[model samples]
Target: MQILIVGGGTGGTILGNSLARRLANEIRAGKVRITLLSASDKHMYQPGLLYVAFGQMTPDQLYRDEASLLESSIDFHVDPVTEFHLDRNEVKTGSGKTYAYDLLVIATGARIVPQEVPGMAEGSENFYTEEGALRLHKRLMEFRGGTVAMVVSLPHKCPVAPIEAMFLLHDFFKARNIRDKVKLQYNYPVNHVHATANVARWAKPEFDKAGIEYETLFNVREVDPVKKIVYSEEGTECKYDLLIAIPPHRGMEMVETNNLGLGGWIPTDRFKLTMNDHDNVYVIGDATNIPVSKTGSAAHFEAEVASDNIVSVIKTGVPVREYDGRVYCFIEAGFDRATHNAFDYINLPELKPPTKSVHWFKVAYNQMYWSTVRGLL
Candidate 1:
C-alpha cells in the first residue's frame, strides 16, 4: 500500500507520524509505504507568531526541519504541489514529480489573502507571516502612542489569534507605560467576538477590564493607507496610527486549482473528515470547511481520527472511526494569565477564568508540540 500526505504542516506531520508508528511492522516488511509532501523544509510553529509580534519569541524558536520531525519509515518530499489529480489518484509537484497513492490526505492548510482587502497590502501590518510579525515588532517598538485598530478581514485560521494579539498589545503598551496614550480597539465581522457564544461572553469582562474596545458586526470593506483609516461595508469607519490586521484566509492554491474546494475550502464530511466526492481522500486541519476553531489542537484531534480510520480501512476495508470536531485553545489574556477552552460538536465549551499557570502551560505546550510530532507526548 502507498500512502501520500500533502502539506507538512501540523495536521500532515502528526498524521504521518501517527500512521508511521501504527504501521511500523508493515513498513519494516516493505508491505506499506508512506510519503509526505511539503512546500518547504522548515515546519513552523504557527501559533507562536503572535509571540513573535510581541517580541516575546524569535522566528528561529518556532521553526524546525520538516524532515527531521517524521519517522525514518516515512519518506519526505520537499516540493510545492502544483496540481492534484484526484481522478487519477496522482499528485504533480512544481519539480515535475508525480506520485500515485492508494490513500490521500489533504492537509494543505489555509493561505492568507491580504490582497482581497483594498489598501490592506499597502497600509496594514499583518502578524500572520514571519516577515509581518517581525515588521510589527519593529513598528510596535518605535510607536510612541496612537490609536491601534485590530481588524479582521474575514474568517481566518486560529480564530482566537486576533483576540490574543489585542490582549498582548495591551500588556505591551502597559509595560512601556504608554497604555494611557495608546488606544486599543478590535473590529470583527462576526455577530459575536468569538465563534462560541459562551466564550465570547466570558471574554467580555477581560476586554472591559483591559480597556480594549471591541466592535462586532464590523466587516472591513477597505483600508486607506494614505488616510490611515479603515472602512466597513456597514458604514463604520476607524482611524488608526497603526493597524494590525488579520487578512482573509482561504484554502491552498492546489486545492483551489483542482476545484476541490467549495468557496476556497475543501468540502468534507464533517464527522468522517473525508472528501465529499472521494471516499479514499481525506481532508483535515485548516483546509476543511468544517465548523471548527481551525486551531492546531483541532488539527491534532482530526489527525488522530483520520489516522485510526485509515489504518482500519486498510486492514478491514472500512473506516471504523469518526472525528468529534474537538477543538482546544488557550486564550492568552496577557499579564501572564491565560484560559483554556475545550469543546466538540455536541458540547459547549466551559468558560474558565484566566490564570497565570495556564499561561505557563501554553508556553510549555509550544515546546512539547515537537515531541508530540515525534509521538513522544
Candidate 2:
C-alpha cells in the first residue's frame, strides 16, 4: 500500500511521522510506503507569528527543515501538487510526476486573502505571514500615538488570535508609556467580541477594564486609505492612525481547481476525517470543512485520529476511533500573562484566569512544537 500525504503542514507532518513508526515493519517488508509532498522544504511554526508581531520572537526561530522533522522511512519531496486526480487515486506534482496511492491524506492548509476585501490589502496591516509580521512590527514601532483599529473577518485560522492581538496592542502601548495616547479600537463581525461565547464573556470585561473600545456586528466593507477610515457592512465606521486586520481565509487553490470542495474546503466527515464520498482519502486541518477552529491543535488531534484509523485498517482490516472536534488554543493576554482553552465537540471550553505560569508554558511550547511535528509529543 502506498500512502501519499500532501502538504507538509502540522497535520501532514504528524500523520506521516506517526504512520512511519506504526507501519515500520510493513514498510521494511515491502508491504507499505509513506510519502509526503510539500510546497517548500521548510516547516513553519505558525503560532510564533503572533509573537513576531510583538517583537517577542524572531522570524528565524519559526522555521525548521521539513526533512529533518520526518522519520527515515518516510519519503519526502518538496514538489507541490498542482493537480489532484482523486478519482484515480493519483496526484500530479509541479515536477510532472504522477504519484498513485491506495490512500491519500490532504492536509493542505488555508491562506489569507486580504485582497478579497476592497482596499484592505493596501490599507491594513496583518501578521498572518512572516512578511506581514515583520511589516506589522515595523509599523508598530514607527507608530507614535494614535488610534490603532483592529478589524476581523470570519472563517480565519486561529479564532482567538484577534483577541490576543488586542491584548497585545493594549499592553504594547502601556509598555511604551503611551497607553493613554493610543486609542485601541476593536471590531468584530459577530454580535459578541468573539464567536465563542466563553471567550467573549471572559474578554469583554477585560477589554473594558483595559480601556480598549469595541464595536460588535461590524463586518468590514472597505477601507479608505486616503481618508484613513474603515467602513463596515453595518454602516458603522472607525477612523484610525493604523489598522490591523484578521483577513478572510480559504483552502488551497489546488483543492478548488480539482472541484473537490466549495471554497477550496473539501467536504469531510467530522468524525471519520474522510472525504465525503472517498473512504480511502482523508482531509484534515484547514483543508476540511469541519466545524472546528483551523488551529494547529485541532490539526494535531485530527492527524492522530486519522493515522490511528489508517494503521488499524491496514493491520486488522477495521478502523478504530473517531475525531471529536477537539481543539486547544493558548491566548496571550498580556506581556507576562496568558490563558488557554480546551474543548471538543461535546464540551465547551471553560477558560481560566490568565497567569504568568501559563505565559511561560506557552513560551516553552513554542520550542516544543518541533517535537510535536515529529509525533514525539
Candidate 3:
C-alpha cells in the first residue's frame, strides 16, 4: 500500500510519525511507502509566536527544521501542492510530481489573508505573517502611549489568539512602565470569551485585573487606517492609535479549484477524518471547519485518530479509532499565570480546573513540543 500525507504541519508531522511507528514491520517489508509533503522547511511552534513578538521568546526559541523533524523512515518531499486530483486518488505538487495513495491525509492548516480585510492592504502590519510579526514587534516597542486594540476579523484561525495578544501587550507595557498610558482592548465578534461558559466566567476576572477591555459580539467590517477607527457591525465605533488585527483565514485555493466544499471544507467524518465521498481521502486539523478550537492541540488529537484509522485502512480497508473531538489548549494570562482549557466538540470548555501547578508546568510543557518533533524526525 502507498500512503501520502499532505501538508507537513502539526497534524501532518505527528501523523507521519505515529503511522510509521505503528507499521514498522510493514514498512520494512516494503508493503507500504510513507511520504511526507511540506511546502516549507521551517516548522514553527506558532503558539509561541505571541510571546515572541513581545520578546518573551526569541525566534530561535520557536523553530524546528522540517527535514530534521520527520523520522528518517519517512520519505520527505519539499514541494508545494498545486492541486488535488481526487479522481485519480493523487496529489500533484508544484514541481510536476504526483503521489498515488491508498490513503491520503490533508493537514493543510488555514492561511491568513490580511488582504481580505479592507484597508489592511493599505499596509498595516499583521501578526500572522512572518514580516508582520517582526513589524508588529518593532511597532510595540515604539508605542509609548495611546489605545491599542487587538481585534480579530471574522473566521480566524485561533479564536483566542487576539486575546492572548492583548495580555501579552499588557505585559510589554507594564515592563516599559507605560501600562498606565496604554489602553488595551480585545475586540471580537464571538459571544463568549472561549467556547465554554465556564472559561469565559473565569476569564472576566483576569480581564478586570489586567484592565484589558473586552468587546463581544462586534464584527469588524473594515479597518480604517486613515482614521484609526474600528467600526462595529452595529454602526458603533472605537478609535485606536495602534491596532493588532487578526484577519480572516481561509482554506487553500485547491479546495475551491477541485470542487470539494462540503460545508466549506472537504467533507469528512468527525472522528476518522476520512472523506465521506472518497475512501482514499482523509483530512484533519484546520482544513476542515471542525467544531473545535483551530489550535495545535486539536491537530494533535486528530493526528492520533487519523493515524490509527489510516493504519486500520491499510490492513483492513476500514478505520479503527473514532475521533472524540477532544482538545486541550494552554491559555496564558499575564505574568506566570496560565490555564489549561479542554473542550469537547460540543463547543463547551470543560468546567473542571486543572492543577494550579499548571504555571510551573509551562516550563516543562515546552519540551513536549520538541520531543514530538524529535520523535517524528
Better of 1 and 3 by lDDT: 1
Considering TM-score, where higher is better, how would the candidates rank from best to worst?
Answer: 2, 1, 3
lDDT of 1 by residue, 237-317 (tens): 999999999999988877788888765699999999999989889999999999887788888999999999988887787
Runs with alpha carbons beyond 4 Å of true place in candidate 2: none
- Superposed by TM-score, candidate 1 places the C-alpha of residue 182 at a distance from the truth, in angstroms, of 0.7
C-alpha TM-scores of all predictions:
0.98, 0.99, 0.93
- Clashing residue pairs, candidate 3? 69-377, 70-376, 70-377, 71-376, 71-377, 271-323
Tens-place lDDT per residue, model 3, 1-377, is 88888888899999888888888989999998899888888888887767667766677877778888877789998887877888888888889988788778888787777786687656355677666677789998999899988666767777666656766677789989999999987776778665457877877677888898888877777779999887777676778898887777777666767677742366778866777877677788888856667778888888888888778877887767788898887766655656777767665675434344775577566657867655432
Q: How does residue 86 of candidate 3 score in lDDT?
A: 80
What is candidate 2's lDDT per residue for 171-279, written digit by digit as tens?
9889988888999999999999999999999999999999999999999999999999999999999999999999989999988888989989999999999999899
RMSD of 1: 1.1
- 2 or 3: which has the higher TM-score? 2
lDDT for 148 in candidate 3 is 87
Which candidate has the highest TM-score of all? Answer: 2
Give the 10-residue window scoring lowest on summed lDDT in candidate 2: 153-162
